[model samples]
Target chain A: MKQLKIIKIGGGIIDDAASLAQFLHLFAQVDGPKILVHGGGKGASEMLRALGIAPQLVNGRRITDAATLDTVTMFYAGKTNKAIVAGLQQNRVNALGLSGADGNVIRAVKRPVREIDYGFVGDLTPAGVDAALLGALLGLGLTPVICAITHDGQGQLLNTNADTIAATVAVALSEKFVVELHYCFEKNGVLLDVNDDNSVIEKINLTSYAELKEAGIIADGMIPKLDNSFDALSQGVSKVIIGHALKINDSLKTVLCLN
Target chain B: MKQLKIIKIGGGIIDDAASLAQFLHLFAQVDGPKILVHGGGKGASEMLRALGIAPQLVNGRRITDAATLDTVTMFYAGKTNKAIVAGLQQNRVNALGLSGADGNVIRAVKRPVREIDYGFVGDLTPAGVDAALLGALLGLGLTPVICAITHDGQGQLLNTNADTIAATVAVALSEKFVVELHYCFEKNGVLLDVNDDNSVIEKINLTSYAELKEAGIIADGMIPKLDNSFDALSQGVSKVIIGHALKINDSLKTVLCLN
Candidate 1:
């Protein structure tokens, strides 16, 4: 069976160029096919401010109104997307940057809101994800660097969460390939003790993840990350790893199962 | 009949906040159904450089190689797209930003290269333009701000020229609306002499444009602008105006009409 990996770099990992570089180095050496999806949550917010626009978020996702939508497209798709691609190129890795809107690779409908409108946030429909096209790109020896942006049916920008994007891609590509979800952050791994970086959990199954979340040990952003990891696994992905971007190799060894 | 205008701002016009502000002021006063399509050629290139990526342009268009394509999408679709939308919002215009790939609004086939491989550039087919969806947005009292980025059928980034995009859009919407193509620049208008900025020609018809080209007076980038303008007019656009962005009202008097 062919090997495929979907590595998602968190906003924290992307904020640090050094960590991103380290992750890219490991990504370049990895055998088999891989797709890299990244988020520019903080970067995009800062950029919007510099341009004299206030960033807005709705339901943990960026509210991509007309103005905010343009900013996200420019910053996420233009600046951060190019920077990541350039960094990969410097390491002699052939990477292609893409938006979910491009080629309808990720088709979606605007997430309908009841009271406060979420503007252009989209909920992915199964019809929207294109695994065959992505598989072909990987077969051509190219790594796809995807930005977390999508579009509604009527030509609108929708800010998508990168974690969900990675999970969706992993599930879509899992049947024909061994899919591994690498969730890279600044810390070593999912810690058993919140204060201890050395208390890295060697591995996590779906049951442990549920227990941790239920006990409130994993709250906030970590909850979504864990949820998305299990979602991918349930959809047929072979493994899911949550680890530090800089020390990804160690985490990969612990998390990825080949069989 | 509801009058509709397709105002196109060159990437040059929106390079800075001041210029954007000036354009937005003009944009707000235009009371009609309108669509705004913008270019980010220079802005995208500059941001690419900041990220240490050398942008390669073939035939005056960014060659969307794996690296450059990634950068272009981020900059054009994300950064530049948002800045314009934000500027419009700051000026009280509810402008929404969108790309050609949205809802398959603008689809095209990858242009087959003749001399050099223009990696990921697209040639717009008539079937690719989405006028109805755009018309629906205008009918809903929203000005659509479009970025000149599109996707080929195979999920590849296609570097499309802004002028062509504007022209195609004009033609696409011509049946239901009176479409006008406004080509705004820093100069007062197209001048007879290259050295004199004050030598702004008040008006010119298609015949005069041909005469100027025949005399070798029109050269470089101006040639394409005139070509695209004429293409729009010939394809049923009500008129095409070329002038300073701030002098849109004055430029309206010099509109080139086929009739």
Candidate 2:
């Protein structure tokens, strides 16, 4: 099987123009087929405020009402996606930006009316991804840059989590490729000490990840992120990498393995 | 040569929900491979107004400064493009939405400041389109839904005119396909009398078009639009159709030939 890298970048890099440019430069240097999945940055929130709509959050997750969905769709799928694609183009990468609605690449179901009613949020499963179409796009020498927007295939667009999108896509494409999922953000890696910049935990297997969580070294917000990474590994992803977006080509990053 | 229909829809239909849905349904039924290029509708202007940015226009053409470019890019490439793609997806068309920056399918040069500084606006030529990539996309059994946003290939997004994008794309693809360029607007073809819905001009050739212009039968804004259609015909586009968006399947329309 061929090798494919699925890289996901969060708001920290996207919100800063210089860091995003540096990341794009490094990404262009990566040799092999890859897909970039990006999250909506703070820009969306700013725009929401500008438009006089205050964002609603429940348990660190956005409560995606219709207006918020519209704003985030514009920011993520529109402005940020286009900017990143144009930057990659300038760096000589033939990048094509996509919302899940494009090509019906990711058909998601609206998170059912649960306790909170997360208005227009989508919950995706591995079965929702169109792996063959993605493979065809990569076969065409195009790197797809996906935004955190998906449709229900019944004509309703939904706000989705970018990390979940990347993981799901990585798992789907694993049938055809040795998929390496990279979660790129502002950190060097999973930190050994919360306040130390150089306290990088280089590698974490499933056992040590449990120990690290039990030891309180990987507590707080990193828990869910690492949980998601391990989930991808268990589902046949070859490896998962966590590192700074600008340091993608460097060896100083955390690597996760199922073992 | 294979037949390819390149359809361009203006703002009027897009501004209305039912009409846009009807147009998409009609578009999905058109046999053979096709591409849809849509203009930035009133949504952008509404957004600009909501954001408290007064839109600037010079002689009916928008002056796309940096802020204006950002808003239009979000509306056209983001919201409108995705809405159309999802709608087509519901109708079972494998629609892939694109900004010109995506796949580097179209690259444009920023309009130079001669008499007017149109800011970040792009002026496209036929040579700027990547016909082979488009052919590859079409070969993949996907319908491309292109928005009127292009890149300068130097990390800048330029607001492009959708009509020119359609015509230029038609000319570009003529090498591989028998291209029929359809300009679908609110009116049912070029009316002999602007007030009468039944005054449809069934067919117009170069000679008759010239005579109509001399006889003042085609005047005002319609003159420039027809000029563009004839120019496209002369440039090797197989034909240009002018019709109401909803009446595309019916024969109550005008067809321009180079004869």
DockQ of each: 0.12, 0.90
- Give TM-scores for every candidate, taking all chains together and pairing residue i with residue i: 0.57, 0.99
Q: For all candidates listed, what's the TM-score of chain B alone? A: 0.91, 0.99
Cα lDDT tens digits for candidate 1, B165-198: 8888888889789887887777777777878777
lDDT per residue as tens, model 2, B115-171 = 999999899988999999999999999999999999999999999999999999999
DockQ for the candidate 2 complex? 0.90
**Residue B102 in model 1: lDDT:** 48
Per-residue alpha-carbon lDDT of candidate 1 for residues A149-235, written as tens digits (9 for 90 to 100):
876534455788787788888888886798888877778777777898888777677677667778887788777667666766777
- Error at B221, model 1, angstroms: 4.1
Give the range where candidate 1 chain A is weakest over 10 consecutive residues by summed lDDT: A250-259
Which pairs clash inside model 2? none
User: lDDT (CA) for every model shown?
Assistant: 0.72, 0.95
